[model samples]
Target chain A: MTTLISVPLGEHAYRIAIGANIRRQLPALLAEYTPLTPKAPALIVSNPRIWRHYGTEVHEALTQAGWQVTPCLLPAGERYKTLRTVEKIYDAALRQRLERGSTLFALGGGVIGDMTGFAAATWLRGIAVVQMPTSLLAMVDAAIGGKTGVNHPQGKNLIGAFHQPRLVVIDPDVLVTLPPREFRAGMAEVIKYGVIWDAQLFDLLSQLPRLDRMAALPAEQLLQILERSCQAKVDVVSKDEREAGLRAILNYGHTIGHALESMGNYRLLNHGEAVAIGMIAAGELAVTLGYWSAEAAAAQRALILKAKLPTTIPAHFDVEGLLALLQHDKKVQAQKVRFILPTAIGHGEIFDQVPTELIRETLHRLQA
Target chain B: MTTLISVPLGEHAYRIAIGANIRRQLPALLAEYTPLTPKAPALIVSNPRIWRHYGTEVHEALTQAGWQVTPCLLPAGERYKTLRTVEKIYDAALRQRLERGSTLFALGGGVIGDMTGFAAATWLRGIAVVQMPTSLLAMVDAAIGGKTGVNHPQGKNLIGAFHQPRLVVIDPDVLVTLPPREFRAGMAEVIKYGVIWDAQLFDLLSQLPRLDRMAALPAEQLLQILERSCQAKVDVVSKDEREAGLRAILNYGHTIGHALESMGNYRLLNHGEAVAIGMIAAGELAVTLGYWSAEAAAAQRALILKAKLPTTIPAHFDVEGLLALLQHDKKVQAQKVRFILPTAIGHGEIFDQVPTELIRETLHRLQA
Candidate 1:
């Protein structure tokens, strides 16, 4: 069954299609939204591992649909997400002679989606990008939003653009190859959606027998996870396309999460794992500040632990270092670090007045 | 007195302030449109030469207006206008802790404006940018349009984004130190506005005693040149912000102009000189195809000569080589080289059916 969610962003609005084994339907799906010019050049940007497993199927689908396809593969990892790596995509695009009317298909996980989307955003001063996210994290979160970027040496996603994709194709079947750790990391963001915007989603996840890996969940439950998480994101992003206001709620765990990812040099913890720990810290802060109940915060931590995601900061992580990085965050305004804190299970709000001392105490409590 | 031209792009609308010695009014002008946060961080991205000339004045003006200013100087010239140089701006922005509320002030020629605007467009998914154009080309043309980008090795402006500046401050007084050749190069684009949009602008240049340097013209004539050229740009760009339709007319001489600029490796001929030759070649093609009058074509060439700009393709330039580069242009749609051809002195339209053989003939006949 195909579930379509529309992101109403005026002229920039697009639909997200979630289903099982829908990779072959890419061309037809894209044509429904944007008419495909026959024989027009399209570049498929993916990493080596994802490309090895799924590239041929997608390339064949587009080729059958009359797109002149070229595969550009990059080394797979968060470490490789930089402008230098994005330049490789630009090189392949130039070689393929991709023009304003051409499209770029980002056919991997979040890292690939971001770099490819950013390349599409800036190439010829903007072009079209179709997201075909392979990993769970990407399907539910990264691929749905128009946020595309690469990591700066100083921070994660410090350099980027808000270029929306023309279409997003999510296939749950691809999660068969995603590692268990990565699957758990994806759950971190899934849990984030529950805590910040969807109380029912949070309760549904709480009732699951297991949330650690793809094999443990039924096909129906998996589909629900993808649909609900994506719906929650669409609800927030559609109202605030550029994160001017309502969108900050989506960053519930990201403020501290991004700093943790950077402190670990993006090699130690994946984005979702860092977010998992970050949500724990934010939950504690919310509870301590009297904005949320201790019972709800405990329920949030229980859900995180059930997913087998990390809830405690690593022992080696320095509280002062994390604090320093927070000041450098893109969300910092007027020398104050802005954070998204949960006030209830189904809602979050922006808070810029959180005291440094209180945050320091929260980090101390969060440390393993 | 400042001549204000408003670019009516809805919420993204901004004004272009053109006047003599108006650099000091930047703070007041920007405040009228977008409220400035007190002590907000602002980075000045410029080249060494232009910095040596007017950087201190702009720095002081912004500082006096309560901006925490940091000057980031890059090496001067087109060769330095690449992703590598833009990285320096990113690094400086990071150092300054520039957040979403921060601003990047582009205070140089087109190269500086383009790079700084691209940096602003991508830095933290975009920040505010105020275009403080110090060169004639930038003052009348590049600074007004929000077309920010850096060139790829394969072509010019192959990598970029459509990021509009919050405000544009044009101080023609900065042109006092501009080299004679650079001033003439700026006139080429002014002449383009004539052929493509304003016939009176064309006649005004014809009536001028000389069309060479900044010092040659009275301050009143220079203000008119800046105002009319900018208005022509504002009229076209405000209608088509992304070059989806009517805006392609702005590329009248740019199709061949970009290829020649690339062939010269962006060194042998500056942008204006190459465009001067491109306009002549385009005019010849229009006359040959009966789309334009031969007398108008001759008059266009005569004006180019009057401005001391090149009307002939250099002897070393190869027609086939130039044709090859044309195929790689960003404007190439469905593998067709789209050209903006003139039907009269003040109007141009898109034509994708221009024969390659005709273009080759035009290029050969125009060779020095």
Candidate 2:
């Protein structure tokens, strides 16, 4: 029994379950909330490819378990995480007549989780949502926190609401079908935990066989990593449900990561891939500012490189475009482009008053 | 100096400044937060009528006090509280290059306050706002609460986020410009507080001269009424920040009130007037259920009539149209039209399971 962890957010606490092939346990999870002020119909939202593979089984499981399940298929892509897509989901919910008491089932990866959680948050003020994460990316990072939203053209997550989910079902078996590239993308966020909080987990990832050949993590290995990652997330959210101070730690690589994401036009590099590159940029600054020894910085760089992740920005990414994207980053998307840099290995500082001269020098380094 | 009462919601905790012309103190208020969080250029959201009256003085006040204030006048009507208007304000904010920390000044009434607060909430995820409520309804009710958003075409407040304003500056001086009928519309909500929490306030309202002429309330009278009203709203919001149970008491006459507002095309009877008539219908129900004596019901009717408020639904109103609109009331927009029927002279209960026959009986009384 790999135990379940709870993120205590005042009255919005939710449980995060970890285990192998826990997909079948979803029905039981839904049953757990049956006595919790019984909701209206449950709307299971996902993409077409996901629907083809696991939709029927999950739908049947929920139905046989006696839930009123209504499945809604959304177009799969980063582009679909917009107000336009939100409108479509809104239309479907209204057309299907899902009321305030209804439950939303977010049953896909990161994009689906964000858009669905936002939809749940905004429709008729708000509704209950249960996260059924299918990908490694969603399982470790996106699924736990109540930060749900879509991207604005100006910047990502520029329009969002803090709507907590009823429960989060993380079944490691779901990650088995992830492709090599996507599998490694998820590792970027996992590595973030090590860089900011756990030095031991950093060593663990440095020792893993290059993830290119591994389709899924071994159940035991997967459970340990997930439980630790979720525990870190729960600890942060518990202290600061609204992301005031302690929550900024979670955005260790996100400032540079978001800029890299927008620079790639939201397609070429996956989320974690961009963050991996961002971690490299932040590490360089850590070395330059004498916060970390050159040897430690080199070791951090070596581990990330060994993971088969690129440590440099792509050659074709426009520097000005990237800078503009950074300017639009919501953290300080205000008057200046602020960056969160590592003070030393296993520690970070959110710096907003840094001189623009240093910022330009770092951007120049990315000009491979 | 009447002491201001602060509602404690921690960081979102704010005080309701209930004095004569709290408007002149606006510059001092801006100074308090400017050193910590500088907001240079401001966007003042108001209606045309309000602009013609007090806009110059407000703009000059902020500008001379070392801030650039731009006024964005919205159409003055309840029907204008839709997403389209909100989107328009968002566009204006974007065009003005409003930064994340820039404050949106809600300057007209409840409709303006709700829409402006929502724009601030959604623009760049969230921004600060200060309520400069002009109407009696807004000063006592809408301006103080953190609830802010626009109405969806399907229903009122269907699309909104919980965005608390940084300040609420109540200037009873602005009431002098209000139309006779509009003034009474606000008193309906005032009476709401008295009926739900303080019967002493209710007795005081009955003693005030009929609300025919527009004038500044006596400084002492203004302080007490605004103070009591703020306390009533704050108590409800503090107990149930998310409108779970006790907060429902605040909607005493709003269920059928919304129906009446929609039936009259939002132009005929203002929100307060519809609520005025709705309270009478609830009073009739009190009579039906033995919760209200005939004397209490008549006294309530007499008080509203003295205020020159609407006591019955108009003859021109189609009963079916009223019922159809009732289907979209924010409280019961989805699950079969919830009503806050009066149980007694000093109390009411939120009834969600009431049958259609009772509604029809009440609608017929409105017709009669």
DockQ of each: 0.84, 0.40
RMSD of 1: 1.4
Q: lDDT tens digits, residues B233-308, model 2?
A: 8888888777778888888888788888877667788888999888888778767766668887787777788778
For residues A278-302, write the lDDT of model 1, one tens digit per residue: 9999989998899999999999989
Q: Name the candidate that leads on lDDT.
A: 1
TM-score of chain B of each: 0.98, 0.91
Off by over 4 Å in 2: A33-38, A96-99, A213-216, A318-325, A333-337, B1-3, B30-36, B39-42, B68-75, B89-102, B216-224, B316-330, B333-337, B352-355
CAPRI docking class of candidate 1 = high
Q: Return the TM-score for chain B, candidate 2.
A: 0.91
* C-alpha local distance difference test of each model: 0.90, 0.76
Docking class of 2: acceptable
- The per-residue C-alpha lDDT of model 1 at residue B234 equals 95
Off by over 4 Å in 1: none
- TM values, all candidates: 0.98, 0.92
